[model samples]
Target: MGWPYLGETLQLYSQDPNIFFSAKQKRYGEIFKTHILGYPCVMLTSPEATRFVLVSHAQLFKPSYPKSKEKMIGPHALFFHQGNYHSQLRKLVQSSLNLNSLHKLIPDMEAIAISALDSWAGREVINTFHEMKKLSFDVGILSVFGLLDESHRENLKENYCIVDKGYNSFPTNIPGTTYHRALLARKRLKQIMSEIIYEREEKKIMEKDLLGYFLNFKDEKGRVLSKDQISDNIIGVLFAAQDTTASVLTWILKYLHNDQKLLEAVTAEQKAIYEANEGGRRPLTWAQTRNMPLTYRVILESLRMASVISFTFREAVVDVEYNGYLIPKGWKVMPLFRNIHHNPEFFSDPLDFDPSRFEVAPKPNTFMPFGNGAHACPGNELAKLEILVLIHHLVTKFRWEVVGSQSGIEYGPFPVPQHGLPARFWKESNHHYRH
Candidate 1:
């Protein structure tokens, strides 16, 4: 088949991506053609194609999709910047997420996790997703900008929701539309970021938080970055770090709840670590978090199975050739990670929850939870720490069980619990551990 130009396909794809992507893979193999909102798209479904598009030839594939950029993240975000500007901003921002910094932040991360868990005591049924989202947001605020005010926290959360909902709606600045609301949210966010930057500059606060680092940062020529550049970079990091971690943790809880054996193993490992620590005097250290290899694998497995940001869309800068097929210039090319992640060729029993798949023998380029290459998520290290620490805390403190049906989780852009991840947790009676 050359290409399928069915209008209904776009509707179906937008409505339920899991079924649509699966049907395309079954019918069209590794590479397929489809249309979205009247634009042609080549959907790449194999690891080879994904590698080529995202890693090998990423320069030719830019992420500044007209709709996604103009509607979703706003034009001011670093996500839409290209060439030297993007490179410089990425470098400056990426420095904050470096391994050493992340290691230093582990105690803070664990303290936040423990605080969140402490608040949930005596509750029978709770939505883990909501709690994780709040906790993740708070951590991001504190670690990124040193935000501690309660009112500011609420405003940030509300603005994030507005912006997230703005992405899929029609692009317009007209009031009452989703896009318009998102624009307003963007404006509000930019104002808050500006105020923060100005205050940091005026007070000369030399703290080690990301905001302080950016404020004092200088370019190669000794020229300091502008306030707008700093604001955009901060917003970009905030957007990427907050929700992605929350989604991963939510899915991890779901998987652990469904699989008793895996949950028990993870819990046992956590207990052993706690027992060795003697007193709960020190928070969960970065060294200890990294030592939890099994916990890391579980988070990776959950991320692989739950394809967050399911497909990445890139417009062809110029005509490109792949397997003798011409991807014409300006055509939308979407690398479908869901298809690649679920493909039996790369993973055995692709649909099953098995962290051992990664433990026994990990596959490079085949498993991309954060993505790949130059554009690969810079906050990957921080995300890993956040997920691992959250799981470590949750598993050690309480035992969780699915409230009702224990069927495998459903897939959204983010793997969302169909029933709000309703789980029952009780304080662990073993009490054999200190931390």
Candidate 2:
């Protein structure tokens, strides 16, 4: 319906995507019909409409992804499941990653944070984006596949880079293309997972990592997940945890650097928590994540200002009408995350960075950095805790300042500091802050 079959696809890719969305919202208003990525789409930005599509009328829509991603993650991937299957997979994933059980993971999480920050201090300049991914990937590998040898874990991280690139690439299978390489990388990961699974089975060991749960648990059909399913879901978890969390962590660094006042306040909050524990350097606990209410507020505020995933896409399985507009069946229904996030109607002076706005909760469905409804991220708590732990350690132990002239953020899928957030970090030794 827009610009031939290409529709408004080029418009999206032409500039800062938020700029395009802002312009379109100014001209068309919210909930306008447009064509994107060769499909008819009805974009929803208001909280009511987002709630309608994501939760209220969710049954009328189904999750969809680009061909490149589907091929990369594979046909049996947990992401493709719906209804009961989706619920079952969600439970299995939650059993290990959810907040209620995260206490068991605090030791590993703290160790990862200390090691990463200590290493970063050795360098004259640390790139925020690269360092966050390394930490996030390390935590994911530790909690999800702790039994694997260090070499295999590094191999997994290496192939993950290729697979991630293909995620946003065009669906071309031609040799020398990123897509081809991504497919090849996926194959290598699968081979590694197969060998690991074989080794675990041969030893009759029932480990406690996410992979161990998948390797041993049976679904309602009374069947264990195949190695292919295990590998595909591992890909799902890794992809989910890696860049998204990294993006948040990178933004946290920039925010703290920009506001020394807020950093001091957050640091004081953590210092109390850190010194409160016996021996002063013990690992955090799951329940303790709630102790730093301000840190969580800053993280939430950052999410609102710049969401990692700009929109959530679903295909309408049936005609659905909202506020007198009809979204036809087979159309793509995209919930513009930022539109609602930055909406003046929902957030007063939405452009301002005010963590105190979250001093109280935003209206229901008004804030969903992690998305809402049935498809909400199961690992949301895990990601939050990881961020909290890292921020806690970094703030209490070191002081940082932005090193270069950053041009601000640019979106490649999600927003990132155009400069990669180069920063000079100093490890604190005095164990105290001066007012």
Candidate 3:
């Protein structure tokens, strides 16, 4: 703790958070106590400790977030709760992302990726992360609502962007503030969702989407999910899908850009699939997407390197002890994902961008990009599917060059390449597409 109440919040925010975390770990060992965001938190960096908190002893800790954030994303979201409600809501979400559902959405996901890449082609300079966000958002929508109308999609995107921008801003309801605008936008999102939900209910549509699962849900007590509950969970899933996936995609681009040989290898791997698909005339099969071992390793390495979620907050529901330390009830417990990922003990030469390292899996519990245990990201499968689709089309049909210095990282609450990795893209000539 730095100050009486302010704590080390300034120190954490004023510099690179990784640097702060590293410094603290060096001085205080793998487990240390620090106050952040007005809460006393115990930060655990070792894999055993992390596993204990997130997996084995998870019942003693409940998901926690700032009240302002809870309100911003809708308090009814599953991430803010545990127990029966969380379990039930999580099942509904999982039903929509299951393999059968994702298989049906593959064509739509590929279409979104192709359209996005085509639009970015020949651009002077586009922010790769922002463009990727659009692609991910479209896929997210497809997963949640099936084929939404254009007008509805546009409205949802506009409002959602406002809410996303304001999510990390200072929590002030004062007039003319970013957070205020965000709150208003969040309301608009809820209203828009209500209209969509009402339409589904009135039409009696029963499609195999997340909305369908929510619509058809009835609990043990025969209680149906409230409209507010459904809306919050949809928004929450979208929030989870967008930035985290986009950030990792951006890092993949930067890492490939820095290493010509690796880029060539990844492109070659994807090119084999392109040729087998009859020179880009065929859609990728689920099996083909599953077979790109080299590209898959790249994805795994990027996730490990980015560690976007970084650390998650879980409050001690009751006093708990681990490794001879006591966590008082109500204190926050954080498992430092980035630190664990970068620790040399787990990943040799951790700072190097080596996709090959993933050829052999890391020891159990050492690699958790989407978190661990029950509250892990539900849309993870869908996220990977969309990424594979995009990369398949991208490497086979387009070539891009970073437009600015590509060495810096920026955190808009998640680590992304500086300025979202400004880059220029052009279509790969038809000659290259020929067998």
Candidate 4:
């Protein structure tokens, strides 16, 4: 069987996974050929092949895909940079998202999560996705950007969505187009950031937030980053930090709703922790989250089953030989994460939603929710903290039920519930109850 043209097939495959699974099985087997906007692309499904593309031979590949920049929040952001430029920018961004800094941000994260929970305590129905999205946005603004004003927070949330829609639109800046609107949105966001930057510079506010760190960051030449550079980097961090966390948390809640036994186990774990910290003197700490081994396993499992980023594309910067296949330069190589995650050889009953798959022996390099190699997501640790904290609060404070009795979820570019995930929330009447 040979490859097919990039038209209805690609669109259909992206929108509908059953069709994609069938195509992968019948047409291309494990590896397939396709095109994105008329560019040659090879989609590798096998774990070994994906590992080769993403990790082993990563240097030969670069994330230079045409839509990479546009699909991200803006051009020249961290996602699009290459080589030394990428390395340098990644270092500066890493300062704020590093382990120590992420630990410091946990107190702020808990406050945001708790505030959201308190607001929805007596509500009959709520959208967990929307709640989590707002929680994440608030955290990003407060912890990352050091912006705590209510009006500013609301404005950033609105502007961020517009920018996200713009990035997902086709890369065109024509009037009345999504991209055009995104440009306007970007300009608004930039203007806001410019004012913030100016104030920080003028007032010499030496706070500990991400913006503060960036303001003080200096290159090897002892030069501060330009205003445009600061704006681009800030946009990159905000985009990377916000939506990806929301998607993962949303999926975790969905999986917990579907599996009653798992949900019971997770809820029990939360109760144990809450009871242990009886005094309100200490909130759920980062160390405590780290101690929740079951929670971590569940998160990893959800990431494998409901991968937010379905496939990752890297352009072959040079001809490479892998497992006797000659991958020529300039070919767009896609690491088909869905296939690798569900491969029976690496994961037993790969289709089943089982967190125990990660309990015994780890699944090698096959499970890469944060991707692998040099260009891996820099905010991976922060994302994990966001998930753990949100889950902790939800499982401990309230109970939820999925709107439908569907067995599985639908796949968007990112996996989302086919029916909007509607759930009722209530305070746990019996706080000391055991599972």
Candidate 5:
């Protein structure tokens, strides 16, 4: 579908990715062949095709994170795990971050959201992407990870930024290259996490956060997980959940800002819910949060449009066929998530941001914001809760607008608000605010 060795790698990196994929779709059918990022890959765009790869033949695939990413995130990453080990890890995470346990996170989440909103109230402009990243990172570390990176913000954030940029970068071993920097950053984070692990263990300190669960969780053999494994998994959890959720939250704001009607409607819903809970704008219980159906739809539509993780790669462990296209063994297969998510056939007038479209669930395999099959994101509830809680506070309190030289979306590896979606934000005074 592309060049001899490089395939469509350069085209993907340079050109508008939608245009690139659209042009290729016209040339080849939905399930076509191409080589990119050092593999002869098959890109699945159709829902049926994606399902066959992700579900029908789930066991035949493994996560295809590049060599550089493997090094940075470590062997404990769910991407590198498979079979029983992967399932066990997911169960452990779900146990701690699930609905019941999630209630404990609400207060911290609300406090952080309020403090951040207050900070922005006096500011001239806020970068949506940057600000959300800080908010998400803070909540994740302080509330979710047992304050693991509570005091290591600069060091941890620097290393995470390096690793994230290197996720899709060329795997060059040269001293100045992105890959090299990412590797060095990975080393630093490992050292930092290792220290945190040891400190927690030696002190025998137990907090109700995910770190405590990880440290105390034992397998069938009654053996607790090692410090390195816990540390690596913590890094992986923060890496996977933090930025992507932040990106979605940023886009949610941008969309709400663009459509005043939607913003008002969502705000009305939040206001009603808060008033029902005695009108104090306090952190909500789990049931209270999910009770706002339209707010939930807004979250869903935002996820569909933003599609933070545009594509997920899996390595075919054996030869497979989809839509009569032979997918050879060992080839990398990527589910073109956004393509399907944005497909006109699946969503009427797909390009439009209409939260009402989510009123009715799409057909099977058609709406996969968190992916599908065995590898679907386990922390989906937590991610949604984070977004839900933050948005609850936002629409209930503030009115914001995009303000910058230009505003748009920069979608590739992740969808982010272009130019960081700088915006002017302010909320009513505390007395005038709902209380």
Candidate 6:
């Protein structure tokens, strides 16, 4: 804690968050207390502590966020709740994103990737993370609605972008403010979702997508979900999918671009698949996507390196004790995923960009790129599939170069390369892969 009331809020926000958290862990050990954003928080860095808060004793903690964020993303979003509601919604979301269902989206996902890459080829330098966000948004829509009509898709994207821009802004609700505009846009999104829901209901059309799962669900009490509930969960999933995936994808590109040898190896792995698919004439199979061990390791390393979701907020539901320490009720508990990922005790040469280290599985609870326990990202598989499909097309068909001297990270609430790794891409020549 720092000055009165303000506490350490300024210190936490004034410097790089990683530096702030890492310094605290260095000075005070794995579990330390601090005050920020007007709340006393216990930041946990050790794997055991993280597991206690997120898994083993999760019942004693509840997910917490600022009131403004809850309102913007929808109060009924699944992550914002626990107990029966969270469990039931998680089941539906998990079922929708299950392997069997995601496998079906491969062809469509590939097309989205190709289209995105094609749009950027030979163009002026573009922000890779920003472009990846659009790609991720399209994939999110595909997973949620399963081929929604073009007009409705465009409408949702437009309004969602406005809401996203305002999400992390100052929470002032005055007219003309980003947060205020986000509120208005969120209303428009609800209206658009209402229309889509009405159409689905009127047609009694139920496909095996997230929306389908939500629409068809009935709890043990025979209670059906309301329109607001359906819309909120759908928006929640989209919000979850967009930035995190894009940021990781952006980091993957930067990492690959910076290491030519690694880039060549990943390119070779993808080229074998490219040739197996008859030089892009055939679609990528689920098996092909699964077998890219090298590429998969690169992805794992990127996720660990970036740790986009550095930490998560949970509040003690009741006074809790762990290993002789007392956590008073109402105190916020944060599991520092980034600190654990970068910890030397857990990962040797933690600062190096080494994908080979993943050859052996990580120790229990040490590698939680998506998080841990009941609240781990349900769409993680889908997110990975989207990344694989895009990388398959990108490496096999396009060559890109980072366009600036960018060696720093920026946190737009998620760590992404400075200026989103401004870069240019060109279609790879057919003969480029020939010996």
Name the candidate that leads on lDDT: 6
Q: How high is each candidate's TM-score?
A: 0.91, 0.96, 0.98, 0.91, 0.92, 0.98
Give the per-residue lDDT of model 2 (tens digit) for 121-178.
8579878898888899888887788646887888888888888888888778799899
RMSD of 1: 2.9
- Give the range of the ten consecutive residues with the poorest summed lDDT in model 5: 426-435
* lDDT for each candidate structure: 0.76, 0.84, 0.90, 0.75, 0.80, 0.93
Highest TM-score scorer: 6
Q: Which candidate would rank higher by TM-score, 1 or 6? A: 6
Per-residue lDDT of 112 in model 6: 94
Clashing pairs in 6: none
Q: What local lDDT does model 3 show for residue 63? A: 94
Per-residue lDDT of model 5, residues 252-298, tens digit only: 98888888778878888888877876665455887888788888899
When 5 and 6 are scored with TM-score, the better candidate is 6
lDDT of 4 by residue, 352-425 (tens): 99998888865667788887777888888878888888788888777667765544455434666654466777
Superposed by TM-score, candidate 6 places the C-alpha of residue 188 at a distance from the truth, in angstroms, of 0.8
Ranking of models by lDDT: 6, 3, 2, 5, 1, 4
Residue-pair clashes per candidate: 0, 0, 0, 0, 0, 0
Q: By TM-score, highest first, what's the ranking?
A: 6, 3, 2, 5, 4, 1
Task: Tell me each candidate's RMSD, in Å, in order.
Answer: 2.9, 1.7, 1.4, 2.6, 2.5, 1.0
Give the Cα RMSD of candidate 5.
Answer: 2.5
Model 5 stretches astray by more than 4 angstroms: 147-155, 165-169, 173-178, 277-281, 405-407, 430-435
Tell me how candidate 5 scores on lDDT: 0.80
In the range 1-435, model 3's lDDT, one tens digit per residue, is: 889888998898777778999999999999999999899999999999989998998899999999889988899999999888999999989988898888888888888999999999987899999998998889889999999999999999999999999999999989789999999999999999999999988999999899999989998889998999999999999998899999988988888889989888888999998899898888888889889998898889999988988899999999998989999999999999999999999999999999999989899999999899998888888888888888888888999999868777788889888899999999987737343
TM-score head-to-head 1 vs 3, winner? 3
Off by over 4 Å in 4: 1-15, 18-22, 25-27, 67-72, 279-281, 406-412
Is candidate 4 or 5 superior in lDDT? Answer: 5
In terms of lDDT, model 4 sits at 0.75
